[model samples]
Target chain A: AQSVTQPDIHITVSEGASLELRCNYSYGATPYLFWYVQSPGQGLQLLLKYFSGDTLVQGIKGFEAEFKRSQSSFNLRKPSVHWSDAAEYFCAVGVWGGSQGNLIFGKGTKLSVKP
Target chain B: DVKVTQSSRYLVKRTGEKVFLECVQDMDHENMFWYRQDPGLGLRLIYFSYDVKMKEKGDIPEGYSVSREKKERFSLILESASTNQTSMYLCASSLNLVQGETQYFGPGTRLLVL
Candidate 1:
């Protein structure tokens, strides 16, 4: 069984400041990771995903995540945070095989951006 | 753009009543999934279907059942609605796992059990 852990429950950042959200996963094989964001009263949107190849994957809204196999982490980062970036972020892991190879998500980290 | 549509945006159902949540995708995705979102719990998968008439239980599938009669539509059924089931239900569609496609989510249906 695979699981994801997001260390931060909530993070507050000022506008134009840099942001980083930590995510770690526990899996046996090469893991497939993803980041998703959700606004209030809305569904989730995929921020980015990492399957293989490049260690760094770029996503929508100027967000990027680096997959580190040694650390078992895929942390989301943005150089400058915007007010619109304030939302709940989730980290997920998916297995490659099986019929119901759906994603297992973290508890989520609420991001607050202050202007 | 791929669109996954849920039948209702907000639903209020009485306890012990049977509840049905419908989801449809236009992208011809082979995989459809049902998930629930709580306050702190991110998203818990209830059920999923890889193809028509084929359904599989996810991590938390005790209180929920699903039906996929057609390729594009997946329905989540709650045999008897409970207060604990009062949460946001989301539907997602994706290509098969071998394709490594990302799941596209619906707008979500918020269910309140009274």
Candidate 2:
């Protein structure tokens, strides 16, 4: 069984500060990882995904994630946090070639940015 | 850009009432899915369809059913709405297993069963 864990339930960061949200996954083989963001009262938006390639992948809204196989982690990072960047973040792991190909997601981390 | 739209953004239903939630995607993707999101529970798959008239149970399929009469539309049905079913329902679509791996999501329908 595949699962995702987001260690931080909530993270508060000041504007212009660096942000890092932690994520870890448990899978048997190579996994497809993804990060998604959801604003209040809205659906989720794909931030970035990693199939297979360089460890570091860039995504929309100046977000990036690094896949560390050794650590079983795919951590999302931002050099600077903006007030508007406050949202709920989720880490998901995809089952490769599964018939339905559904994603298993973490509990999510709520980000709060202070002005 | 691919667009997935849900039938309603907010819905209120009474206990034991039958409820229908519809989702449509313009991307012509072959796979459509239904999921429920709750606080601290994340997204749990309810049902999925790989083709028209075909449906498969996901992790959490109890108290729910689905219909995929067309490739572009998927409908989730609650046989008897219960308070426990009150949550945000999301719809998603993606290409076939090989070509389209990323699932595009709709704005979601918030269902409240009283």
Candidate 3:
């Protein structure tokens, strides 16, 4: 079974400040990791996904994540966050080539950006 | 654009009433899924359909049923709606499982059961 854990429940950051959201996963083999963002009353939007290759993956809205196999982590980062970047973020993991490719998601981290 | 559309953006139903949530995707994907979103819980899968009439239970399938008569449309049904079932329902679709595919989500339906 695959599972994801996000340590931070909520994080507040000032406009133009760098932000990092930690995510850890428990899977047997090399897993596919993804980051998703959701606004209030809206569905989730994929930020980026990691299958293989480059450890540093860039996503939409100037967000990036590094896949660290040693720590079983795929942490999302942004150089400078804007006020509009305030939303809930989720980390998900899935098996490499499983039949039922369903994702197991973390609890989610709510981001608050202050201007 | 791969668009996934959910029939209702907001729904209100009474307890014990039957509720249906419709989802349609234009991408001709082979996999479709229904999930519920809550405050602490990010997104819990309710049901998934790999093909027409081929449904599978997800982590949380109790009190929920699904129908997929056609390839593009997937429906989630609540036999007896309860107050605990009130949540945002999300629909997603993806390509076949052979390739590394990412699921695209719909706008979601907020169901309020009272």
DockQ of each: 0.60, 0.54, 0.59
Tell me the docking grade of candidate 1.
medium
Estimate, for each residue in A25-112, the C-alpha lDDT of model 2 and write its tens digit.
9988888999999999888899999999799999999999999999999999999999989999999998754555668889999999
> TM per model?
0.96, 0.97, 0.97
Candidates 1 and 2 compared by DockQ, better number: 1
Question: B44-88 in candidate 3: lDDT tens per residue?
Answer: 989989999999998899999999999999999999999999999
DockQ pick, better of 1 and 3: 1
lDDT of 3 at A57: 99
Worst lDDT run of 10 residues, candidate 1 chain A, spans A94-103
Q: Over the stretch B64-103, how does candidate 1's per-residue lDDT look in tens digits?
A: 8999999999999999999999999999999875535689
Q: Could you say which candidate leads in DockQ?
A: 1
- Residue by residue across A39-99, what tens digits does model 1's lDDT show? 8888999999999999999999999999999999999999999999999999998875554
iRMSD for every model: 2.0, 2.4, 2.0
Each model's lDDT: 0.92, 0.92, 0.93
lDDT of 2 by residue, B1-114 (tens): 999999999999999999999999998899999999999899999998989999988889999999988899999999999999999999989897542278889999999999
Q: Could you arrange the candidates by DockQ from highest to lowest?
A: 1, 3, 2
DockQ, computed on Cα atoms, for candidate 2: 0.54
**Residue pairs clashing, model 3:** none
